[model samples]
Target: MKLRFGLQARFLVAMALVLLVVLVMLGVLLQRQRLVERESEALSSDVIHQLVDGYLHGQGRELATRLADNLANPLYYSDLDAIGSILRDQKRDDLVQYLMVFDTAGHLVHDGSAEIEGYGQPMGDPLAAAATAAAGPHVQATAQVLEVSAPIRVGSERIGGVRIGLSMAVAHRFEQRNAERLRGRIDELSQRHQGWLALMLLALLAVLVAAAWYVQRLLVRPIRQLAASARRIEAGDYSVQDHGDTRNDELGDLVRAFDRMSESVARHDRDVRRMAYTDALTGLTNRLAFRESLDHRLMLLRGSGRQLALLFADIDDFKRVNDTLGHEAGDEALLQFANRIREAVEKYGGDDALLARFGGDEFVILIQEGDVRASATRLAEVLVAELRRPLDIHERQVFLGTSIGITLFPEDASSATALMKNGDIAMYQAKVAGKNGFRFYSRAMDHAVERRVHMEQELRGAWERGELSVVYQPVCRTSDGRVVGAEALLRWQHPMLGTIAPSVFIDVAEQSGLIEQIGPRVLHAACTEAVRWMQLGEGEKLFVSVNVSPRELRRGDLPEVVAECLRETGLPASSLHLELTETSVISDELQAAALLARLHSTGVKVWLDDFGTGFSGLSHLRRVPVDGVKIDRSFVADLQRDPDDLALTTAIIAMAHSLGITVVAEGVEKESQYNLLAERGCDLVQGYWLSHPVSASEFTHLLARRMR
Candidate 1:
C-alpha cells in the first residue's frame, strides 16, 4: 500500500514529521522560558544589597538631612519621597524600574507606574504566592503582574516592605536588547549560508518531478501503449506504431522488448494475409483474391441490376522480355504493367474498379459502374498508350506494350469466371489480329469462336472418328476452258454443329496440333479420288492440288508427307500439285524454299494461292521453287470496274511469265474479263466464265462431255 502511494505521498508524510518536530521544540522552549525570571530575582537581590551598603556608608547624608528637615512639620510621605528620590538619582536601572513601599501594615506608599518606564517604573510584584518572608529577595508571577519584594528596615523599626510590581516590558526589553545582538550574529551566519535552504528545496523538488516523468515515460506510458498496440494487433491491425522509446534503464529495456514483439506480430500478420490473398513479389491480388472480389461484385451487380464489366490485358512479347532481358527485368516489367493498369483504373473511379495482376503479364479489372465501364475501348486505349511508354531504370530505357480485351456484364456473362473467359476469348482475337491492340467481346465473335472450338475438338477426334472429307475445286485453263488441275479443300461435316466454316475451323485445328493429321487425310483422299480418272483414261493432263498451311510446311515433312500419301494412293508425282498462301511462304521463307525445292524435284508442281493478297515479300517468291501463281478472286472480280485491278493483274501476269511461272486468273465471270486475260497472255483461269468450283464426278462428266 505504501509503495502504491508513490514518492510524492511519501514526501508529504516526511514533511508532516518535520512540522511535528518543530511544534515539539517550540513547546520545550516555552516551558524553559519561565526559569530566566528566577535568575533575575537573584540579580535584583545583589542590587539591593549594594544599595544598603551605600546607605550605611553615609553616601547620601545630605539627602537624609534635607528629607528630615522637610518631614519635621508633619509631612508623612516626605521621607518616603526623599528615599525614592535618592534611589531614582542613583541610576540603578534594573533595580529601580518598579518601586513600591509599604508601611509596617503592608499598604502601598509609593508604587511605580509606567509613566516612569523601564527599570525606573517597576521591578517585581509583592504580596504574591511565590514570594515569602525570607531574609533575601523573592519573586512571584501573579495574574496581574510580576512581583519582587525585600525587607525595608529603618534602624530596626522594620517600617514597611519594599516591593516592586513589575510589568512585562522590563523583561521583554531585556530580551529584545539581547535578541538584537543575537539577530546581528544570525544575519552574519545567514549571509554565509545565503540560498542554501531554498536552493536545496528547489533542487529536491526538481529531482522528484524529473524522476516521476522518467518513470511514467519508461514504464507507465509504454505499458499503456503496449496494451493498446496489443489490442490493435489482436484485432488483426498492423498499422499503428508503438511510440515508446528505449533508454538505458530497466523499464526502457522492457519497452524495447515490447516494440520488437509488436513488430514481429505485425509482420507475421501481414505475411499470413499475403500468403492467403496476395502475390508475393508483385504485391497484386492473387487468383484466389481476384476471384473473391470478382464474385462479390458480380453478385452485387446481379442483385442491383447494375452492369459489371471486365477488361483482360496481355503484354505483347512478354516471353521475349523474360527470355532476352532476364527474369529480373521481366518481373519489373510486370510490376510496371500492373501500375499502368492501376492508373487506368483511377480514371474509371477506383471504387468501382477491381484491378488485379494475373499470372505472367496478364491482368484483369472489374468495373461496377456503367458510366465508366460503358466504354471499355477508351480504357483499353489508355492502357495501351500507358503500357507502351518507356520505363527508365538504372539508366536503361525499356519499351513494353499490351493487348487488351473488354467483356461487358450480361452481354458477356453474369458470373465472374464467365466474364473472365469472355475477356480471354476477346484477347485471343486481339492477339490474332496482331499484338498491341484491343478487342471488344461480341456475340457473333463468341459464336464464331465457339464453332471453331467445337471443330477443334472434333478435329482432335478426326483420326479416331473418321469425320473429315475432301471436295475438289478444279483449276482450269482460261484460254480453252479445260481443266488443268483440281485443288482439294477439306471439309468437316461436324456431328453436332453442321458445316462449320473452313475459315473458322482450320485455324483452330492448326492451333490444336491436329492439322498434321487432317492435312494428310485431305491429300490422300484427293489423290485417291483423282487417280481413278487417270487410270480409266477419262481425263488428260489433270492433277490433284492440295493446299498446305504453315504448320505442315514448317514440319519439314511436306516431302515426306507427300511421299507417304503417294505411296498410299499409288498416284504419279506429275498428277499432284501443292498450293500455299502468301503467309506460309513469308513466315518461314528459307524453310519453305528448301521444302518446295524437294517437292519440285519430285516432279510435283507448287502454286501460290491468293497472290498479291497478303503482306508477303517478293523475295520469297524467287527463293521458294514453285511453278504457278493464282490471282486472288478479289483482283479478277473487280477487273472490269477498277483500273487499278487491271494494272495489278497485268503486272502480276507479266512478272509470273518472266519467272517461267504460270499465271491462273481466278475470277472469269465476264467475257470481257476473259478476253482481257486472254489478250494479256494469262496462262489459265477458273471461274463462272469457264467453270465453277466443281465436284470430282462433275468435272469428270464435264471432261467426258467435252471430249467430242
Candidate 2:
C-alpha cells in the first residue's frame, strides 16, 4: 500500500525531522562538552601533579643537601649523635617514609627508628651500596616512594662523606590531594553545562513545535479547505463557500481563481443547456426538449384519470416560400409563425399547455388541463387562423397557412411516440383535406397512413417488377370526330392488390418523392410510343400528351428530362406535350412559367390538366405559359345535368379561345356530352365515349384505322 502524505502530515513530518536533527546536534554538543571537561580535568590533574612533584623534589634536594653539609661536619669531627638527631627530626615530620645515614665504609650508623640495634654495623642492602658509591647526591623514585641520597664532604676533601635518604610520600600525598580537588571542580562545571544544554534543547523544541502549529494553521488548514471545495466543484456544485483566508499569498490567489472558475463554469453550463433545448431561429423549445417534456408528462399522468392532448402543426407550402423568396424569408415566416402560435396557445390553451418547435416549419403543442379536446381544438383553430394571416417576409406579404392535428391521451395513443405519430398522421390528413384547418386524430387515419407507407415501399420496386405500364387515351378533333392525339396514362398492376387507381398511388408517389423517378419513365415511354404513332400516321401530325406531377415540375429539371427523352426516342419535340395541373402551375407561377417557356422554346407544348378544379385557374392561365387547358372531369360529368357546370364549361371554352388557348374537354362518357362539347367549339375531346385507355398495340391499331 502506498502511503499518502497529505499537507498536514508532511508538515508535521518535516518539523519532526528538524526536531530530530536538533536533538542529534544537542546530544553531540553535550557529548563534546563532556569530552572537553574530561580533557580539562586530565590536563589540570597533570599540571597539579607536575607542580607538586617539582615542589617535593626541590624540598627533598634542599633538605638532603643541608643534612649532608651538617652530617659532613659531624662525620669529619667524628660526631655520630649529630646525624642520628637530624634523622630523627626528619622522621618526626611524617612526610618522610624512611631516612638512613651511612659512614664511608657503607655501614648503617643510624635509622629513623627509636631503637638503634644495627648501629655501627655494615649495611648490606643495595641502597647502602649505591649511597656509598655516590660521589654526589643521587635520587631514585618508585610508585610508592621517592629515594634521594647525598654524599657529605668536608671542604672539598673526602674524609667520611655522610649520606641521607629522604621519602617521596609527602609529594605523592600532595599530588593526590591536588588532583582530587581539580577533578571535583571539573565535575561541577560539567554538570552546570549539561543543565544549560538541556534548557537550550527544550527551548529549541518549543520553537519547532510553535512553528509547526503556525504552519499547519496558516497553510495546511486552508489547503485542506480548498481541496474540499474542489471536491464539491467536481460533484457539480459550483457554488463554493469562501475559506476566509485573508493572507496575500499564492494560496489566496488560488482560492480567488477557483471561485471565478466556478462562476464561469456555472454560466457556461447554463448557456449550453439553453442552446441545447432552444431553437436558434424561433427561440422556441426544440424537438429534444419537447420529447423529454412529453415523456415526463406521460409518466406523471400514467395512472391519473386526466387526459392530455398533443397538437402537431406543419406549415403548408413552406417550401414554396423558400424557393420563391429565399431561405432567409422562410426563416422569417417561421419565426412569425412561432410567435403567433405561442400567443394563440397561451390565450386559448390553459396554463399547463406547452408549445415547442418540432424542427423546420413544424411545431407541437401539449394541453393537459380541462376538456383537452376542446382546448386543443380551440388552440389549434386559433393557430391555423392566426398563421393564415399574411406575414411580412423580406418586405413582401407572404401567406403561409398551418395545418394542425390533435391527438388525445389514452384515446388516440398511450405513449409519447405513438401520440406524436398519430398527431402527425392527422396533420397530414388536414393537409390533404385543405390547408388552414385542424383535425382530430382517428384510427382510420392511422390505418390509412400505414397503407400509404406500405404502398410507398412497394412502389419503389413496381417499375422494376414490370407491374407498371402506360396506357393511351385517344383525343379526337370534336368537329371531324378524328383522333388527333392520345394522352399517356400510368397504371400499376399489383400482383396482390390487383389493379390500383392512379388517384391512390399517384398521391403516394408524390408524397414519397417517387414521382421524380416514375414520372421520367412514363415520359420516355409515352414519347417512344408516340414516335410509333407518328410513323403510322405518315404525313399526319399526331401528338402524345404525358401528365407531369407537381413534384417533378418543382425539380427544375423537367424540361431537360423531356428534351432528353425526345432525343432518345427519336420523337419530334412538337409531337410530345407535357400536361400539368392548375395547382402545380400556380404553386410558383413565375418558376412554372420559366420552366414552361423553356419547354415551349424546344417546340414541346405545355397543357393545363384538371383545369377548373383548383382555386386559381384564371390567375394561373394568365401567369403560367400553356398552349391548351383540359377541362376537369368533375365539370364534364355533370355538364348537361347541372346548369352551373354547363355555364362554367361554356365560359371556360370562350375564355380560352379569347386568350388564344386550345381547350380539350375530358371525361366525356356520353354522346350527348360530346355533342354539347362539340357545339361549344371545345376543339378536342377525350373520354370513354370514344374509347377507354388501351395498350400501345391497341392505340397503334386505332392510329392506323384513323390513317385509313
- Indicate which candidate wins on TM-score: 2
RMSD of 1: 15.9
Q: Compute the lDDT for candidate 2.
A: 0.83
Residue range 521-627, candidate 1, lDDT tens digits: 78888889878767656547678888887677766778978988888888999889888887556544555667778887777888998888755435456766779
Q: What TM-score, computed on C-alpha atoms, does each candidate reach?
A: 0.50, 0.82
* Residue pairs with clashing backbones, model 2: none
List the candidate 2 regions with Cα displacement exceeding 4 Å. 1-52, 62-137, 149-264, 408-447, 476-482, 538-540, 612-617, 634-658, 669-685, 688-690
* Worst 10 contiguous positions by lDDT, candidate 1: 66-75
Q: Highest lDDT, which number?
A: 2
In candidate 1, how many Å is residue 275 off? 11
TM-score of candidate 2 relative to the true fold = 0.82
What TM value does model 1 have? 0.50
